[model samples]
Target chain A: MDRSGTMLFADLLGRAKTRIMADWSAELERANARVPGRVSTQELVAQGREVLELLQSAASSGDSDPTSAAYSRLRDLLAEMSRARAFQGFSPTETATFVFSLKKPVFDAFRTEPDLSPDAMSAGLWTATTLIDGLGLFTMEVFQKSREEVIIRQQREISELSTPVVKLWDGVLALPLIGTLDSERTQVVMENLLQSIVDHTAEIAIIDITGVPTVDTLVAQHLLKTVAAARLMGADCIISGIRPQIAQTMVHLGVELNVVSKATLADALALALQRIGRRVVSASPAPAVRASA
Target chain B: MDRIPILKMGHALLVTIQVDMHDQLAMALEEDLTARIAATGARGVLIDISSLEIVDSFIGRMLDSIAAVSRLLDARTVVVGMRPAVAITLVELGLSMPGVNTALNVERGLALIGVSVSGDGEHDAGTEV
Candidate 1:
């Protein structure tokens, strides 16, 4: 911990990191040469792990720049390699590399904006990095450790998302939107819902977002698309479970969604049943949806 | 982000969609989902959206491109996600959902189909249910 010793160590770490990065770039060129045009997913992923191991050890020795540089280089490399879908596999090393690539954006966000609020920070970080479904969005920060807990509270929402459509009624198909809709999930939701519509030839699609914590502009837009696409097919998509905060966020954002027919799940159900010309059994008020849950 | 099956479901197949699903993360979704939907041998598709929040030109165009590619495979298309708010906005903005069969949800959505969905549902969203 001596000042000179510490300073010398830091310098050495920096030089070593720079060297590793430079060497990695050279390795990439060699990899491309070996392939003659395209690098296989294995090569990209394997190279990614090599870079991570070197950087991680260097990181352990108080070398932020090299660690950061290694991360930057890896990010660029992955983006380029991502052109091929075959690179997506559960190889432990590849998985680790993908995780590193995903998280690096969050880390960079923090490093760049040292003065972000908690919510803004999370959203900023979330928005900055794309979360690929197979790629893990793990956080080293203590705060996000309870993300699993957050999902737990919203189990109903979570369940509904993965829930397969059963003909609850003769003509009704339901899609439960349990969690908040990020753009990525929204795409999945859009694909699933639309496919279900065509597959089932559904007349009623219920998107219940009771699990969503907030509704930002992106989420709102996803909702809008659902309703529109449904109408084009001569069916109706009812969106239930609009959290008050989300309503407020929509208003605050000055985005008008007056044309979309939105209501609570109770209302969505009633409307859907009516559209299908079916009589409902539950005229009694439905139980209150969990606000936190 | 786990688009395992979606990626596996590549071109010539098409399915309908009904939402304005977009964001930085959506790019990956489009890449994988489009690939997978194409794999299904749909020969046509329809995206019904009456629940979406916004339908800007960029998203509208993305839908069009997706449908156009599906068309090249001789797969017909109908863009279905069109909430009233979005429709009005799109009209005002001079945009269209373009080239896909859009419905309200699965009922009208599936009526256009050529294949049957497996009884089992796909619930994998990378998070446990």
Candidate 2:
């Protein structure tokens, strides 16, 4: 608490930076954090140095609490590092190791301070332990959040990709749904199909659900909602690809798809063509060979 | 008090809702549509909502009511050109407007109502209720 003690702590921290950097990098390598190719050793060392410099200044200022305003710069650095690691596909352990590996080098620095009493040495080591542990945990928390954001964004992209509305004919469109019909996905499916319907001036839309894995009550409801939305846009909807199992499930659930449905995409397309006064006729069979028999 | 104009095309009445329909305006449109349907003995009513970006449950109910009224008068109603966003919102709101018929555009809607786009009587007979 005295001026000399504070000055000595600052001097020790200044001397500890290089040792910590070297030891931390070696510790990370020992921990195999560099194996993932997510971050290069040089990049990791640079980041570690910046964090250590900030930590030394804050710690010497008597700001031991990681969550305090004094540690804001250190927190930002750790958060940025964690987010980068998360997006780069590093494991949470590896991300946290970036912070935890600093503990050994810091404690070594405290041990080299021979002028300090035994009690002061332990206290300094404890402060470093607490700060390092807090920083490590903060990195994990940020990693989790960033990973979650990545997952949610990927889910959105997948949902958008799964619902593709293809124009089967001038006035007909086909939407082949290939996944579970959750409420969010259903919203995407309906919006995409309906937008295509309006754009194509499609008279009929065939929603093929063969790629859909199951037909629960909720999924059926979402399908019906899509159908209704399509119909509202002045497009008749034909739900195709209702496998026998799905049909059975629908029957057992007593879910009536009030709209017309076909068992196959080809059947739905054929019917759609027929409704629009068009039909695909097979080309005349190859001229029969009179002497074949 | 803006009134939605109802244009007569052959034996069908076309109402293009280009403005945002409030409660009163929706009710008035419903009344006017029913009265016109009864007086003109219109065989089909086509309501175009392509320009409408939002259709809450209230407007959704109005569409249903209009369809029901037209059906009772022996006239078919086809709602056409509903925007995708509006349709999605309506479905999310759990108002599907089951009683109303929908078409992709006015041309197809007229065909559904038994009137040809070229004003021909070829498909008109099939549309009679």
Candidate 3:
């Protein structure tokens, strides 16, 4: 708080910079923060040195509050580091350890200050603890946000991948849904299926829900809407992959698909082929008769 | 008043909606289609809406009305080329157009009505009734 105390703290940090960085990096390594192979020892040490230098300068600026404008540079550095670590797949503990690992080195430096009395040493250590703790928690918060963003993006991609419309036959299309049909995914399914129908000029679309785990009223409604959209596009829809459980659920829920549904994709495909005047007949065993003769 | 044109293709009447239809234009189209169906004795009516980006509840109701009127006139109605967004929006708007037959395109619409006629030849025999 006083001018001499601030000068002593700055001199202690300046003299202990190399030792603090070495101890901090060793601590991070012990914590397995660098085990993910995302960051190298050299890069980690460089980052630690930059952060320590910034912390030393900010603390010596006569403002001990880490949240003040004096610590803006330090805060920005920590935020950037946490965001990068988050995108690099660092766990929350590993991300926060970047700041938490510095506490011991800083406390050791404060202890080694011979000229400081017990009260001054305690005050300096407390200031370092508060600043490091605040920054560590900040890193965790930024890391969580980044992780959430990654998860949401991956979920969107997975939903898009799940709904694929395949051209099963010349006049038939198949959409094998593989997950729970939420409203968003259903929209994707409908758009992909309808677009394929238009592209192939298919007359019948077989929507196979066998891979779908369950069918609630809402899912059933989405299916019906998809069917209606396909029919509106001039293609009658035949729902395939209606497992017995789903059938019972549909009946129990009184959710009428109002479209023809088959027990299996093969059956649906066969019926679709039949409607298009095509049959998959096996050749008779005339070769066996010739061999017997 | 801009009137939607209804072209007669053999026994079927074709109405391709290329403009963003207002309530008045949609109503006029419905009246004109009914009059054309009566005058031409058409057995099938095809409404192509591929170019129509938006179909509000009013236009949706007009479509239902047109289908119902056509059915009363003993004609099969097929609404074809509905955009995917429009279909989704229509369903979300709670206008499924239950009575209207839908196809993917005009060719399919014609095929649908044609199949219905051939399948129900006896029904076509009493067109006047």
Candidate 4:
């Protein structure tokens, strides 16, 4: 709190900086040595040295409050280091260990100050402990935030990748949906199917829901919206792959998928072909083959 | 206000929207289309909106009304060549435009109305119904 007390702590830290850093590195290695090569020894030493230098400067400014302007640089550096460790998949404890490991080495240095009275030594130790603990908590906060951001980004990518519109024939498109139909995924599915309809000039789109696990009201509504959107783009949709259980559920729920639906993808393809005024026939008739032989 | 031109193709009236439809223009088109349908006695109306990129709720309602008016006049309205974005917007706006038949292009629209695509004599391609 007072200028003289902070000055004494900063002075001790600067004098014994090397000894403190050496002991801190040994402590960190013992705590996190199981994850070999996760961080190189040289990088660890450099990061430890940087943190110590910032702490010494902050203390020399006569401010023991970690949230003060004096400790701003140290706070920012710790937050940045924690974010990097989070992306590298470090646990919260491992990320905080980078800051907490300095507690023992610095306290040991303060213990050997011969000119200091016992009361002043204890006061200095209290300030050091609180400062390091505050920084460790700040580091963990940033780590948790970065991990959540990674998860959100991956979720967006997966949703985009899941809905793929394939052109089954010259005038038909098949969208084989393979996951639960959430609102977000439904939006993606609708956009992809409409764009493909325009590109291929498709007259019929077969939405095969073999991958959908259930047929609830919400899921049925989403499918109907998709079919309606395709119709607006001048393409009719054929919902195929209605499992027996899903059909039963649809009946029970009174959900009418007024669009033409088929029991299998192949049957839907046949109907689509028929609507387009085409049909698949065998290339060689059995009677013709026997006559030729 | 520049008017959206309407062309007579066979027994159908073809209106290709090349400019953005403002409120006034859309209103003008509605009146003009109804009058033309009455005067020409055409049995089908094909609206090509492939170049139309933007539409709000007003345009959506206008399309619905145009279809309704044409139906009263005993003419089948088939809106053709709507862009993908426009269709998505219409769906989101909850204006499905029921009773308005949609086709991918002018050729399909003609086929829907029983107008032969390759026939040279437009008069012979009468309404199917």
Candidate 5:
């Protein structure tokens, strides 16, 4: 009953491969229709044939445990399939269904086996249930892991894309900060701004936070730290783009940004130009601008 | 027993720390800078630390003391050429060193000390005390 159960199931699987595949394909079509991703009939048939072949060999090894070395190749193939389907935006249920759908067809083949003993029949059924269930859970694990990897990669890319230092003028750089300020983001911002100061020999850096949603004590502290770091590198930071609401919130929180700050980027730039001993004067005394219709 | 070379450029004194600093070296530098300020009656002191790659809490405190002592001696001290990594580290360590003035390089440092960087070696107006 122990070893012969899996071997009997393996033998029946090989003998009824064509009939089981036909039933599995029909089950897969019903499951696939509910899923968002597209798996063409030809590709589905090909994958089914491959999985059936691998499963037959693995079951013949008389190891009911899917994690056993005898099932290593089968595990690899399922892991690969789940990873691919995960990237294709398939849900966890859909991926696991690909393995679970094989259960019914394989069990139906057990019923069709002629003159099968009651003991062997029950043992094979138990083996089939455990083996297929283990494989289904495995696909789910692989799917979830791949999804987590994609999320982490996207988080890193977003942080990298958020910080950009622009050279507004010679010796003047501007960092337009959008979104919230976390410690990790502040670290990236400070690094990029400081490097820009050294690279461009910039004397003044304008931190425009107009796009920032709110100003809490933590965010204000991060701003002050960045300012101090810039000052240590011989560049002064001017924080601008203070919305009326953020200004009120800051005042209420008593967040003292000792460094110079202005209401707008233009005002900060003007102050910066003044500090560096530069003046922008109009060349013509005529109208500053003439709108032509 | 190596001493950091201090070159007198007109009314401003230039001290370029080309080697890693130990406790004794830092102490010697602080003493020598004060003595030099008293002896030379220099108006500006520019310490170029661009070559310095590492700093500790002791060094941070030493810089603050140098700036304080030099200020008492009626000399404006501007520490210049701090690397980005050093600045970030200092900030993370909570050592802002507010007493010291910083500049990007020697040229900017000289300008901050009110010394015109002329090739003809012209001594201009000194830093305001």
Candidate 6:
């Protein structure tokens, strides 16, 4: 019974390797179909080596490949992918597309490999899932670290940057700020604030803070600079509704906002009115008025 | 349904608006205030935003319109006591009334209008010039 069990295990490993090689060859054929011209022999050889190493790793890790032919084929196919990656010059979109191209075949073969022992099939899926997860993690890291990457690539995609301008006050300009203000956002803030200060001669600028989660040092610096800049342009800038945690962070960080008068948006407007010499004594209510019929 | 009136404070017209004011409210308020401005020739207008949770595009637009209309009427409009998140959202969303005034609280709003908050409900006028 033990001898039969060992033989069964050997049979399962052989079948799993065969399935992997077959799927890999199919991928190579499809890629070749897309780019039939100028795929140098050297590129093929190099890519072939990558596949070889992967198969070798499988063999060494106790994947009982019969006669090593399956391992050889896998080696050759990986070489092709590596060459394609190199030819594409590692552009993320191109690279992602290439990798994405192979995803289905890999998944399908992995899913349909009935010859694989249940354990072997599960292990293959686990390996593929982990690899895919790692790739996603890597992409996210790239996005954070390389601002230029996103800026250059997604310049047209950021619809928020060029959103329509809606003026809300006679001489009182309201700028609602949401999202975490990064340096990039700071530039956006600077442009909008300065332009509005000049264009409308904004007597008071209300910057409300309902969406920001946390105020970091950089963000604090940006806010301070905007306030200072607004004042320089002869505009009274009010930083309103500072959250509790943000206040604590601002204080602890020693980022002094002494230059800009701080108040709730309401207080800021009141102050703005006072600057303009207007006062409201009664709650005389809205004139029970209706829109023009 | 002119439920609210524009209050004449010291130097500015104090208009206590509905916490959730609308374009219709804005229009009525504008007409009433417009009449008052024509009647008294006030120089500034203050719309209190104390009881608001959120301020959307319509309301933000109305505020801008109110301010613009006030400017045409020669009364500078002010919005006071807007919450932090609301303000930030307006900016991020790029909503604006380029020259409206905003305050954190009523006292500051009152102070903006050159009104000294005297004891009880009395407001003494400060140096106006």
**Candidate 5, residues B22-92: lDDT per residue as tens digits?**
98999999999999999999888999999999998889899989999999988888989999999999999
Provide chain B's TM-score, model 2. 0.87
lDDT of 6 by residue, B54-127 (tens): 77788778778777877887776667766544555566556645566555456555655553212222332211
Q: What is the C-alpha local distance difference test score of candidate 3?
A: 0.83
Pairs of residues at least 3 apart in sequence or in different chains that clash in candidate 5: none
lDDT string for model 1 (A126-223, tens) is: 42233222123222211233334455657645644564544446556777665566655655666666566656666667777777777777777777
lDDT of 3 by residue, B1-129 (tens): 788888988889999999998988988898899999999999999999999998899998999999999999999999999887888788778788878988778886887788776675542331111
Give the residue spans of candidate 1 off by over 4 A.
A1-167, A259-262, A281-293, B1-129
- Runs in model 4 lying further than 4 Å from the true structure: A2-5, A34-37, A40-43, A67-69, A286-293, B115-129
TM-score of predicted chain A against the true chain A, for each candidate: 0.40, 0.89, 0.85, 0.89, 0.92, 0.44
Clashes of 2: 3
Q: What is the DockQ of each candidate?
A: 0.12, 0.58, 0.45, 0.39, 0.50, 0.02
What would the per-residue lDDT of candidate 5 be over residues A1-293, giving only the tens digit for each residue? 75889998898888999999999999988887775357776677788789989999999988889999999999999899899999988877778888999999988999988999889899999889989999999889999999999999998998899899999889999999988999999999999999999999999899999989999999999999999999998888899999999999999999988777899999999988877767788787546355331
How far residue A211's Cα lies from its native spot in candidate 4, in Å, is: 2.5
- Residue-level lDDT tens digits of model 1 in B9-114: 2222333333346654345545654565556665445554555676677766776676666667566555544554555455335554545555444443444443
Task: Estimate, for each residue in A184-241, the C-alpha lDDT of model 6 and write its tens digit.
Answer: 7766666776666546656567676655678777777778666645543335666777
Candidate 5 structure, TM-score to reference? 0.92
Candidate 2 CAPRI grade:
medium
TM-score of candidate 6 against the unseen true structure: 0.35
Candidate number with greatest TM-score: 5
Assess every candidate by TM-score. 0.34, 0.85, 0.88, 0.87, 0.92, 0.35
lDDT tens string, model 2, A1-293? Answer: 34334445556778766776788878867776547565677777787778878887877777667898988988998898899889988888788877888878777778776688886776666666777788889999999999999999998889989999999998889999998989988888888888888688887899999999999889988999998788777777898999998899889999888778889999999888877778696676445653463
Report iRMS values in order.
10.9, 3.2, 5.6, 5.0, 4.2, 10.3
Better of 1 and 4 by DockQ: 4
* Cα lDDT over the full model 1: 0.50
The CAPRI class of candidate 6 is incorrect
Best by DockQ: 2
